[model samples]
Target: MSAQPPTPPHMTVDEFLVWASERPGRHELINGEVVSQSAERAAHWKVKLAVHVALLNAVRAGGLNCHVVPDGATVRIDDATAYEPNALVYCGEEAAPSALTVDNPVIIVEVLSPSTGRMDRARKLADYFRLPSLAHYLIVDSNEPLVIHHRRQEGCDILTRIIREGATLLDPPGLEVVVAEIYGAS
Candidate 1:
């Protein structure tokens, strides 16, 4: 039998970034371990695209100095953890053209898939909020017509709202995103 390659050791965020850059496909560093993201279903992709477009349009309509980035941009959570959200919004000055990581993201969006649903609602929710710059974390359900909005409140208190229709008003950055637009019905 052929010899198998040795398993890589747990890596710090910086090391994982360097290693992941040389590899193919998408990967996330979770608590010092490298976890490869699985293939997504069509429904997941559809919602992801819709969320990206909706956020982009909102930014443009509001004329805010913010950038909406789709998947492939990483957000560092800590020294040993980082996440690559399905979509994200960062305000003020834009990052460098070649930058692979976003240091400050005001809004983060994730389209839930069967494999990642649990983590998205739990682990990711907790981790994303750890960043002081994060104001909103939106979890879009691929199997249902739902969007869970998590907004940061005063002193670590997070306000969670389940939205099935209408719009979500994201203040601070001052932007509004209609639920219908995100589901692509309008």
Candidate 2:
């Protein structure tokens, strides 16, 4: 058998950004370690795209100032951790053309797959909320018509709602996304 490649040294969020930019596929920095993301199945991709389109339409129809970004933008959770959400929205100004990270996102989205479901529901639910600017965290189910909506409330409390039909109201950024529109795009 051939010898295994040596593991790279632990890296901070800054270092991970530089390293990830140099490489090709998706990667996230979790607790100072680089975690390579697995290839997404077609279903996962469809749902991800659907959510992006839904959020984009909502932003436009509502005439909100927020900018919606599809997958690939990194969100730094801490000094040693950063995540590339499936989609995200940030108000105020548009991000710089060369910026690698989003400093503030009012809404963050993740489309669940078999491999990521647990982390998305548990770890990510907790980690994404750590951002002061985060008003909502949406976890979309790839296999079914469902969305786990986590909305930040007063103080440190976060309220979660499961949306299967109708619309999900995202305040602060102030937009309403029709559930069917999201799933229909897939």
Candidate 3:
């Protein structure tokens, strides 16, 4: 008898979720491949935590029906196209493809990195704009104390990052953030 070739492994979101649920790490699905996403570096993680806490406080104070998403939560564009944005804010629960395939998120943030900078600025920007609910995209530099926010407008061209607070961080419309609060600590 002739031996057959090895069978390729395949898993659905549900299956992957079950298997990954037992593990103590973050991961994502991109183009049918289960790619393991890495944790942020110590400095980056510190900044991320600080920003998340600030945003959470602001979001809560506003009494808005929104939730701050943790990093590594998958956002599916299509069956084959998915991305785990660094941070995302959704007005209502966007957690179900059982109900909705696309999430109309208002904001998407990606902490800039050396490797992902070009991809985030170019490819990800175009991909993210496909969402009508997307009002702002914040590209934050990990090495520098800067944030470049791209906000959409009704008639005129979208507002680019005009808020250069130097060490002061500024949060514009749709979201409220204290400049000094985030950057002042470290």
Q: Write the per-residue lDDT of candidate 1 for residues 13-85, one digit (tens) a residue.
A: 9888888887778999998988989998898898899899999999999999999999999999999999999
Model 1 error, position 7 (Å) = 4.9
Model 2 stretches with alpha carbons more than 4 Å out: 1-7
> What would the per-residue lDDT of candidate 3 be over residues 1-186, giving only the tens digit for each residue?
666333226556554555455566765554555666565686677656666776777778777777777575656654544567777777775465343223676777787776667877987777677667778777777665677778777853567774445332223334576644555544
lDDT of 2 by residue, 1-186 (tens): 667454467989988898899877999999998888999999999889989999999999999999999989999999999999999999999999999999999999999988888999999999999999999999999988999999999999999999998898999889998889878834
TM-score of each: 0.95, 0.95, 0.71
RMSD (Å) of each candidate, 1 decimal? 2.0, 2.5, 5.8
Of 2 and 3, which scores higher on TM-score? 2
lDDT of 1 at 44: 88
